[model samples]
Target: MSAGLLILFYLGLSLGPLILAWAQELDPRTPWDELATGLGFLALAIILVEFLLLGRFRLVTGRVGSDVVMRSHQLLARAALVLAVLHPFFYISPRTPAPAWDVTRQSVVDQSWHALWPGIVAWLLLGGLVAMALAKEVSGLRYQHWRLLHGLGAAVIAGFGVLHALRAGRYSADPALAAVWLALLALALGALAYVYLIAPLLRLRRPWRVREVRHEADRTWVLTLTPDFRGRLPYRAGQFAWLNVGKPVVSLDENPFSIASAPSAGPEIEFLIKEQGDSTCRTGQIAPGTRAWLEAPHGHLIIDKHPDAAGIALVAGGVGLAPLMGILRELHATGDQRPTALIYGNRHAGQIAYGPELERLAREHGTELVHVLSEPPPGWTGETGLITPDLLRRHFGPPDRHGWLYVLCGPPPMLTMVEDTLIDMGIPAHRILSEQFVYD
Candidate 1:
């Protein structure tokens, strides 16, 4: 089905009960039921479209135009929250006789209040979630901390929503509809359980024991791994795996780093991690014998799948050289002699990751290497001051904007500028590939 049809179908499922109520087929006696059922279905639709159709969880190969999916998910979630609130308040406000709350009221002294509490809690949590999502900035709140709270808050909201629905009976008058809602809820919960519990547990079971952790120059550590399980993890170079450093709390945290080593180099996988964050800061302290969890190679930048082109341009900034190293290694291993040029960008010569190695590889494979230093030493002989359009043209002979494939990996600002330059130079969006190493 077309996207338009899918959207219409989703909307119909969400508003079906309300439409029925408008037609007087849905009993007005169960106003509580009407509100709950409508909200529940709306929430389910949001969950289905995001997790199932949009592939939000499958961070590997999922490509649902980031802007479109993010905006839609946020909008749907906010609408669902509004419906969640209206469901209970509408049902309880003396508007409907033989109310769902009245039934609970007749049962016990404060049963009505108890039934009402879940909805209230859900609303409170949902309100916070929506605010956090929409807010431009939260004063003094760190992004990671806010993200963790957001996740926990979402869980609480979902739980309360489920509880509210179960307690309010009239809205889900049709047993089949109620069952469908419950099934969708269960599926969403299952997706969560699989991601946090089952998948991680499975990864834990099949650990990649630390075979080597060599501290390289420029505060970067080269980690080597040998799968404890018999065979090697079927992975492509330039892809990354989640590394579980072994402290009780740390073990639960998995950080993704590029597979710096070649795929042809056997089961012993390697990653070059630069110490730049809270996680990486302590990674160097990890002992030799600590067991590490590995989530296999995940990225769509594999050279073979991209495009068949004559010449390729690989751009790197600081530690962004890791993936390019993998790409070049793969090209060399296969004897694929496509004239390649690597524009290595860094603050200074000392900050460049894989500098010597890249130079050696270039000499061996006849690939061109151009080092661009942003903050060069007074006597520095390398090309200086950023990966500008002029530098790119000078070293690689004016970018073949329409034809040549440009693979970029760098800090967000640099990447943005580079992308803008490419677009201005008449390169189609599809022809240029980029992967942002956003930790979150």
Candidate 2:
């Protein structure tokens, strides 16, 4: 689906509950009480929608990049937390039993133990959930453990929140509003189940095996995976997949990596991984023929989406060259005639991946390759220092280059700086595509 349609669908789902409550047309409460109820309803709806934004659904993350989806999830969670926390304080209604005439409980807040206990529990748990997520690094929890905790905690909060709404909410007494809350709760929990259970079950049927693990640039390894089945995995050049090597289908040890090899490279998929984490650091040690699994084809960095562009500009920093390498290789393999250029930056010469192949592209495919190093070795003739605006102007400042599609994958600071520089140079924002290597 188009990005605009996806956003409209999201808005419809999030606002459906609030709109239903408003349509109930019950006796109106004071302004503060109405404000409290509105905030509470909105917060619960947003929290339910958070399940689909967890970066697991290909439909959601495929159009928008995974980094964008994940960043939205984090930001929206914080917003929901703020709304939920302030939901009760705005109430000016008395905390006492409802009067006989106040059938909709417009004169008093529901203070009975049965109605209030669930709210109290959910409120406290929601605070702790957001706190733990924000402080995950300092909490000293492993990524896998933290993921499990996060999923369970969210499930509990959803359960309690729904219960509180059905029991204590002024508008929730309407049968239609109660049904809407139940449906939303079911969908939220169903999304969780699909991610943790159903998806893994399907993955178990299409297992892969490690074909090779060869060392490349500094602290980097190029690992290849071959499917146990006959057919090859289909994917775009600049896309990525979740790699679960030497782990079970259900394990959370999988890490997302760009597919370094092109689709034309055959059944065996390749990944250029750096030794950064516990799973990645053991890349070289993984035995050939070890069992592996893949969650294929995620991300929106492919070239087919921008076919009308006159040219392509690829910018890479450190290990960020993986996906771009896939794009370059695909172009070369498919004999794509579009003009192409690469601006690769590294701290030292030893850090550049596929150096000889890149030179081959420069010679055979007419790709313009510019190497930028922060710390150049002796006799180095290339540009020095970071990828500055001056260097960008030297290559891409031409009026013709402004129409070319600019694709970037790099460190967060470098991506931000280069993106800003591109925009400042009058390149339209729609022509620039970038994905950051780090989401946290």
Candidate 3:
């Protein structure tokens, strides 16, 4: 589907609950009371939608890049947390027994312990959940442990929030609204089940095996995987997959890595992995032929999406060159004669991966390869500084180059600098594609 259609679908899912509640035509309460209920309804809806925005759904992330989808998930979670936190405080009505005339609790909040307990539990847990998420990096939690906690916590919050809505909410007592809540809750839970259970079960049928693990650069390894089954791993050049080596299909030990091998280069997928966390730092120890599992082909960095572009400009930093290498190799293999340029920046020459192939691309395929080093070697002849605005302007300043498709993968700071410079140089935002290596 198109971007516009995806946006329309999202807006519809988010606003549909509010519209249904308004259609109930119940007696109106004070503005504050209505505002409180409105915020609760909206927050619940947003929380439910957060499941799909976890960047695992291809239907959602395929059109917009996973980086954009994951970023949206983070922002929307915070937004829902704020709305949920303030929802109870907005009620002006007293928490007391409803008068005979207000049988539906239209003018009073439900004070019964049964109705309020779920809401109280959900409310407090929501705060803690958001807090833990915001502090994930500094919380000293392992990535897999944090992921499991995050998923289970979200599921509990959704369950309790729905229960509270059904029992304590005045509008939620309506059958249509109650059905909406149930459906939303089911979907939220279903998303969890799909990610944790169903997807892994399917992956069991088409497992991969570790074919090789060769050290590519300083503290980096080129890990190759070949399918244990029949066909090749179908993926775009610039996409990535969650790889689990020597682990069960349902294990959370997997980490995402960009595909460094070209799709045209056959089924054996390759990943240039840099030593980072516990799982990645031990890539060298993973024996060949170890059973591996891959959640294949996720990302929108592929060049095929922008065939109208006059040229391709790939900007990569350090090991972020993995995906760009795939794109370059595919272009070269397919004999795509689009004018291509690569601006690769690293701390030193030793940090560059696939250096010989990159040089070959420049010599044989007419790719304008510019190597920028922050700490160059003693006898380096290339640029020796950060990839700055001046560097971009020197290479892509011409009027015709503005139409080129610029794909960037790098650390956050370099991405920000290059993206800002590109926009300042009159490159349209739609023409520039980028994915940050680190989401956290």
Which lDDT value does model 1 have at 138? 43
RMSD over all Cα atoms, model 2: 1.0
Identify the runs in model 2 with alpha carbons over 4 angstroms from their true place: none
State TM-scores per candidate: 0.77, 0.98, 0.98
Give all candidates' CA lDDT scores: 0.66, 0.91, 0.91
Off by over 4 Å in 3: none
Q: How accurate is candidate 2 locally (lDDT)?
A: 0.91
What value does the lDDT take at residue 435 in candidate 2? 87
Task: Provide the lowest-lDDT 10-residue window in model 3.
Answer: 102-111
* Candidate 3 residue 189 C-alpha distance from true site, Å: 0.6
**Candidate 1 lDDT by residue in tens digits, 358-408:** 778888987888888888988988798988977765655554535667888
**Count of steric clashes across candidates, in order:** 3, 0, 0
Better of 1 and 3 by TM-score: 3
Backbone clash pairs for candidate 1 read 33-170, 33-171, 34-171
- Per residue, candidate 2 scores C-alpha lDDT tens digits across 38-144 of 99998899999999898888889988889999998899889999999999999998998988988879899988899888888989998999999989889989888
